[model samples]
Target: MSSRLINEYLREDKLPHIWCPGCSHGITMRAIVKAIDNLNIEKNNICIVSGIGCSSRAPGYMDFNTLHTTHGRALAFATGIKMANPKLKVIVITGDGDCAAIGGNHLIHAARRNIDITTIVFNNNIYGMTGGQYSPTTPQGERGTTAPFGNIDKNFNLCNLVKAAGATYTGRSTAYHVNMITKLVEEGIKNKGFSFIETLSICPTYYGRKNKKGNVVDMMNYLKNNSINVKAAEKLSDEQLKDKIIVGELYKTQEPEYTEEYKKIIESFQKER
Candidate 1:
């Protein structure tokens, strides 16, 4: 279905979006909405939360129960939101800086707890909203305003990071892989425990300009050419997989979710009392 027709599900007055042309934030937002529609979740039952940075503008454009919180604090706020109600389907939208930099602690603990929430990291590889600063996921040897000499720091492999932190569902996809992205988001929403989706989004105005990546199409093509499936990755030597993009669902498992465990403890305490 056309995105315009899907507009019936959105709050259109909020439109004339704030993102630059070819930016993938809108695509990510649409993918989430499409996932929600596919899941048949009640519109009122889902809460979309966001942190500061360009990607944080997502919740503002979305029509669901939304919260635009302080910088790098969306996970903390989302945790509280999930705990208090335990019924709300909370989804946190954050940028790479917001998730892996200042919010690093919150991100890890939330995953460690297997919290019943979905975290979407819009990793455009730079601090797009704040003058194109280098971020934790920025490619090594890449140029940024802060890394004019080329970034010397290693980037975080978000999929492995979240997997190690114990997220029940972990996956990676790029804005270029729209079908896979939409599928993963849908699966994440339906999953009971913590779900982490790292979308390699495009920031044409900032990241593109700094890296000579040109336009959104160029970035998308880069992702397309570089991507490999997890199954295919197993056969390639470590050297061959270096700097290659791995797309598709990386890991998933069934585990007791945080809310369920929390509730069981509360019930047991009440019985003892």
Candidate 2:
């Protein structure tokens, strides 16, 4: 039974989504719409851009102005949309692999430019759409189809990476933390410059089954118990922080948005003409 808000925000004809049972992508997607509903942003003014992945499929089921782009290219497309039509609210939906691996350059450059776009990454730790391959955010030593024994590559801390690259806002939340996800997304939308959010979604079929992380209920409990708010983690030591999720709005600051800067440049050129 879909809520009125879901029916209103989501494309009803696409009901009975293809995501596996216990997949947390649905939870994060709802949070996106709920944030929009809570903020009361004009639906028609919103534009959703997504790259190829399980998370990317969201745009197809959304009623907003949607753009489904090539693998790891959502941010590039979204950047163009925001620059061409500064009035539209451009939001990106991406998975860990889609944003942090092949699309890593675009992600960093966008953050560096301080573009006024909201990027939400569903970091499931594995490339669920590509047969459970290890993603850039996969925990070191975690098993994936590509890493039969365990993942040897170091995982990326997306929040820290975006913050260092100059995003105006950065946040992290898990599917188990619904309210926090919604709030973070709302804050990201309200932010004037590049805003980034990473949600730890459960990929029960691939990640969970392969890693023996138990059923969806077990994974949810893991998120709830192993999570600490950014402020709370301040008092904890490195050892204590291990295996714990540092949740909440991790970073924020004021910055000139890219679109507005470009607009000023255009105005100056017109004055000269």
Candidate 3:
């Protein structure tokens, strides 16, 4: 039997999500749900924001307060939500292009502000929804619609970017590593400042087919075999680390969250008045 909370919180009308087979979106969605369940936060206190893309479609399915905003604007909207309420748990779900490319500025500024919001970047390395256009996180030499010969650009290391931008919590995980991803989401929500999770999802239908990578199972197997925990990766050399996925918490530290600081300033002014 399903719990009343799960049943009541899930938008059953949106059952059977449109992500293709071997697509990691569904898995990532479950991970989010598991995290919320573990945290025991009331549905009313949670708000999900997403930008335009396959990943952005997530808000429509989740039961929480959701806003499916314009492309690369999820974070912008989420910032407003956090600033306006301060008490709500805001989460932004975005794809590689949605976050690293078009929404790059919003992402970095949000981290810089150390807002009390969790940003989950679903990095499949390609623009899955609007044809397989190469994204900022797409690995060099990877083939895509825009890069038939090969991509000449370097990929964005999202964890490093967010950490440098002052996020209080940063982590990376893949869909194949579902348990850890769920745990990371749980941790991000509980964190007091900006929390960023870069999830390496598989868009086998678009990214795989264009890049000569096999189906979903093959990608999952690759992730399982290639990934090493960050701690373990420290001991490996560049040659040994080639083609390997590093999934784990990269950095974490406590910092005064943006909203809390703003609230304090308001209270102080009122006291003075």
Candidate 4:
């Protein structure tokens, strides 16, 4: 049953969301709502932006003002909104293929600029909305429609990549770890500069069957069994950590936010004029 808090955030007319049974995207969506509730953020002041994909469909069910943009361009549109009105909190909801593949360039540059946007990437490891095709985050050797013989491409460690690109806050959590996901998301939103979170989600319809990963329950358990807390990961060697997922905050640092910096620049120019 959806909690009172969750129901308050959703559009009741859009009840029974479109995601397939056993898909974790819905759970991830709830986590986002839970976090926002914990922070007591005014829904009207928040703008949710999404790119094209199954993950992108989320905005339609949300009651807040939202933008369902073109493939891989959610971040670009979000950037514009943030710059135009820095007081509005811009939250980006995107999928693995939408963010890591097509939108990767925008993702990195946004972090580098330290824009005040909270980006939540639903990393299901495959292209769930489009077909069961391999995506930038698909685990090596996992089967996809495009890789019927098992995938050979290397996967991206998105948190690490974004941290390197200069996101002020970076974290990871799974749909199975609902409370943890909620906490991290709240922390990310409170952060002053760009914040990027990667939520490892399940696409049981596509990723699971194609990879011979039993059922939804089994897949959810896989996340619990394979994950290691970042504190404990410090003692493990690279080889020892190869297949283990690292949970918790990976990086955070203070920086001048993009919009604030732009405001300063404009004021200085006006003074000179």
Tens digit of per-residue lDDT, candidate 4, span 34-73: 8988899899999999999999999999888899999999
Cα lDDT for residue 160, candidate 4? 87
Candidate 1 residue lDDT tens string, 1-273: 337635756777878788999998888888878888888888899999999999999888888899999999999999999999998999999999999999999999999999999999999999999899999999899989999989999999988998899999999998888888889999999899999999999888988999898777888899889999888998999999998988899999988899899999999999998
In candidate 1, the residue pairs with backbone N, CA or C atoms under 3 Å apart (3 or more residues apart, or in different chains) clash, namely: none
- Model 2 local distance difference test score: 0.95
Task: Please give the CA lDDT of all the candidate structures.
Answer: 0.91, 0.95, 0.91, 0.92
Alpha-carbon runs more than 4 Å astray in model 2:
none
RMSD of every candidate to native, in Å, equals: 1.5, 0.8, 1.5, 1.2
Q: What is the lDDT of candidate 4?
A: 0.92
In model 4, where do residues sit more than 4 Å from their true spots? none
Q: Name the lDDT value of residue 162 in candidate 4.
A: 91
TM-score of each: 0.97, 0.99, 0.96, 0.97
Number of clashing residue pairs in every model? 0, 0, 0, 0
